[model samples]
Target: MNEREKGGVPDDALIRMTLAGDDGAFGELVERYKGRAFAVAVGIVGDGDDALDVVQDSFIKAYYKLKEFRFGSNFYTWFYRLLVNQAIDRWRKSARSAEVPFDESWLAEDSSPPDGFAYPRTPENLARDRELGDALQRAVDALPEYHRAVIVLREVDGMAYDEIAKVLGCSVGTVMSRLHYARGKLRETLKSHREG
Candidate 1:
């Protein structure tokens, strides 16, 4: 029985219900954020199968650890941090293994075709934007893991600076500074690609 099935209350109410042993309340949280959480894992791991595993495991971890969850902190913030950690671990394992089957085709099906979601109308603009997007991805991947995490959470995820501070267990100023530096590097990398 979902809240939607019964005309819901606030998310915090659902959390309280789940804490009080209503299994459906936890299901509501899962159903709501599963897609976004999976997408975040995929974006970091760059592998569909691994992303799925990460999402499932992260959710299980969250559920068992719910008692430790403090009120006033965003649930998604904790979830995102867990997803990022799982992706990093998978990335490290894939790096060390020689026969892990590296192919972009699977990622391609999940990622996009050339015209998937871009705003370009002209062929030339389309090509240029794609070049920038590819360059941006490469630059982002090259960043230190923590720097990359902060930039993606702040810039890409559009999480508030305070939220990111909580997620990363850092001060808001630290989050801002990391994001500033990461964006500067991305800009420099992109400029060289476009100009040359």
Candidate 2:
């Protein structure tokens, strides 16, 4: 079948197909979204190894619970919520604390940024982006769980407020409020890095 003939052929549609005995369709969905899902996982758990485990578990959970997923809703928003809960569970299992990564051992040692990302991709600029990303991540990690969730959903996931509200099981007002505070705190924390 051509792309259009494959129904709407969206990720959700593929998932529905998977539920209907098309394992290949499920594999397609995994190939399509695994990178994004992994990025979200890493962003949350702050460790490459742990994030990989989360991503694997997330795929398993999504597959088994495919029947439970509501139709006509944003697939990614739903998936993101599942990821957040999974990451939180993993965190609780390991740390038994709600504190973000900076205050924890995960981030304490890596005073330097990642290997590369100055995304001018020049050595200096890449180093700067990594520095900023690292510092920004620390501040982001410090947000209250709800606020952090909103900011990540909105900014990183590019989810609309309504979608985020749906994922978060909160009102748009609550999403906006948490987002406002989250942004304000992030700005305050990263002020030194901002350009004039």
Candidate 3:
């Protein structure tokens, strides 16, 4: 059984139950979305610990704001809006404070690259691939916050344009524009890195 089936309640039903004073219903919501939320958060904040904080804070905010949620809308989209905004804010604060260290540990953990390519078997190729991955990540980090969000939401999460537009509180056109600009910038940065 899927999680919702196992829980025996849909998200709206769970929200209603929570509104009726069943805290467990809300807990189920958290359990359902926390992993995906963390992935999105990490993609934006680029730091696992900060991403954790962002997820926790977003959940807490979501809990308090549950009453404001319009029934029948996708709960994840609403929650994702909060999560993305929180991540961007956190990223901005960290960026302004000092250099935010890029964590390469995630790179090591995944056997394949984010682009779905298998890692090179040879040691030399592996090292070069690692360098390319590092450069790509650094290029992504250098993107503006909204551009980063757009790229991560589209590329990493594979969210549809309309869904991303909803999450980012932008029009579909804006989402497309940001994504185009972000990709162009990354290409330019990576090209310069290669040529240099």
Candidate 4:
């Protein structure tokens, strides 16, 4: 068994081990984050195949740039900067209006209505969920790239504002602004969908 797989080795330790010539330590990091990375990538790029390429490229770039990673800081935050940038670049290149799949489970998050209403297990409610999901997908796809990145990083990935600022290389206020704008746009789209 690899040293990283043995127990609760911290990310910093794995990074140090990787720097000391243990490739497997880096592999452990990849295994730890790849799923979330793929999800973020897909959210940004709006295509699974493009998201995969972005994730792979981001990992390769992160591997080569490991020497630049600052100690005493979160690795995932640094890595996500690269991942988000790659996804945005891919999205810009393609400019495709592909549908990004929305996870219905997110509806259960704190973003739910203030009334604490839950959709019951009825055919009508299920149909409404599907419609909502589709509207959300379209709304997300319509956001500008940076706004989309902010929404995906903040909402979908549940990242803190400061962490998102770090990843996006912007101020916390900027992150808040972008998030507000993105959320406003999404809310407008969804509201129109429901009312119509």
Consecutive 10-residue window with the lowest summed lDDT within model 2: 97-106
Candidate 1's residue-wise lDDT over 1-196, tens digit each? 9556774666677678889999888898888788877766655665568878988988888888888877887788877777778777876677632122333343343556466565435657556656666677777777776677788777656789998788778899999999898899989998889788
User: lDDT tens string, model 4, 25-140?
Assistant: 89989999999999899999888889999999999999999999999999999999999999999999994778866566656545656576655556687678878888988899
Top candidate by TM-score: 4
* TM-score against native, each model: 0.76, 0.75, 0.84, 0.88
Which is better, 1 or 4, measured by lDDT?
4
**lDDT of every predicted structure (CA atoms):** 0.74, 0.74, 0.86, 0.90
Number of colliding residue pairs in each model: 0, 2, 0, 0
Higher-scoring candidate on lDDT, 2 or 4:
4
Ten contiguous residues with the weakest lDDT in model 4: 105-114
In the range 95-168, model 2's lDDT, one tens digit per residue, is 63222233223234355546883323355755565677778887876777677777877887777989878878
Cα RMSD, each candidate: 5.5, 7.1, 3.4, 3.4
Instruction: Show the colliding residue pairs in model 2.
Output: 118-125, 118-126
